[model samples]
Target: MPELPEAETMARDLNQRVAGFTISQVLLAFEKIVASDLKNFEKTLVGHQITKVARLGKWIKFELDSGGALLAHLKMTGQFIMGDWPGHLSGQWPAHTRAAFLLTDGNSQQTLFYRDIRKFGRLRAFPQDELLSFLSQLGLGPDPLELKPEEFHQLVSIKKARLKQVLLDQSLVAGLGNIYVDESLFAAGLSPYRLATTLTADEASLLLSHIKRVLNESIAHRGSTVENYRGLEGPGSFQDQHLVYGKHGQNCPKCGQALAKARVGGRGTTYCPICQK
Candidate 1:
């Protein structure tokens, strides 16, 4: 899964390649992948110039010069590729391509393809006023990197669930998934099963600090590529630097104790019991 870091990297890559280009045409190879009405979707995007690209939590946002926006959520296996649109009916297009945007920059043309092997991603278009309402409906929480320690602690402490479950709640703190949650807990020496309300203020501060550090480090490495999480550029190297995630039976890097694995919040979780407790 491509989390915050992966989405951020994709946004940056897209900004560099297509930000100033105008959309010459829209292709919906898999119309169902679009969340908006097909007629409005294509019509709104056809002649708009992309002014900027940004990431909100784990979603990619394309800011248009026409005072509108295009948003995409790559739920599990979605990705974007840049190249020519394959010849019509030539079967040169890669499998699972859901949509394509043919772009122009006065002197050159390029096609941006949205591919999702599992077909779980969705795209939507919104005018400026409606875009604000759309984002409000999503109710995504503040980005973890920008949250103050006191605010983060209050958010988590208000939840009665286990630490891992609270961390995975996007409404409480956005952009954390299985891998980073486990890794952050390990870094902060906290148990995944620990009750959120039981953490001391100092512990909360430590956890927040570790979360920010881990996210920054992962972003530097281009995010973890444990599954279908390759950015527009390529797979990330952060998977190689993981501490407890996906290392269930391996010796704990810090404690040399056997790492333990269990199901928490219906997701596989790995942690070093000796080191984290």
Candidate 2:
């Protein structure tokens, strides 16, 4: 899954390239990818100008001048790319193009394609009221980048679960996934297997600092392209900067001890067995 950085990169890139364009039409190759009602989805987007694009957790939010929003979650293999308007025929769409937004700015037109090879991503168009209601019902946590150090420490202190589980829980702190959690924990010299309540206030603050640093750095690099993740610009190079997220049994970069791998809440986790304590 593309985490905070990937989503942020997509938002920034799209905002620069596609903001102010009106949705003249919409095309869907895989109708199941629409999370909202089909008729309403097209009705809400067409003719509305996109004012901005932003990241809401692991999802992308495209704000409309008319107060509606087009939201998308790039689940496993989903990504957005630029393309030309195609015929209504599905055969005319690019490979893996699940959805396309036909955008116009009076003078010219463009197409923003949502391609998902795994067909696991989702796209939704919502009126202002519906968007608020859906987000509240979805129960997304506070943005990780916006939280103060004390706020983050207090939030984690009450989890009482494994550090890995606490960090990965979207309802507690949004925008964190397996890759960044492992990397942040390794940077903080903390073990994922440790209980969340075991950390001191200072330790928790340190963890948050590292988490913010890693996420910002990853965004600067456009996010890790370990799988099918890319921005309108291109694939990210942060994967090359990874310390231990995918190293598994490889030797730890810090202490030369083999990195340990295990499952936490059913997600694969890796850490330095000796350095992280």
TM-score of every candidate = 0.96, 0.97
Candidate 1 regions with alpha-carbon error over 4 angstroms: 86-92
lDDT of 2 at 45: 94
TM-score of 2: 0.97
Off by over 4 Å in 2: 86-91
lDDT (10s digit) by residue, model 2, range 1-277 = 8999999999999999899899998878899999998989899999999999999999899999988899999889989998676565555877888988888999988899999999999999999999999999889899999989888888998887999999999998989999999999999999998899888889998999999999999998999999768788889999999999889889999999899999987989999989888
Candidate 1 local lDDT, residue 128: 82
Candidate 2 has its poorest 10 consecutive residues by lDDT at: 82-91
Steric clashes per prediction: 0, 0
Model 1, C-alpha of 133: deviation from truth (Å): 1.2
| lDDT, model 1 | 0.91
Candidate 2 has an lDDT of: 0.91
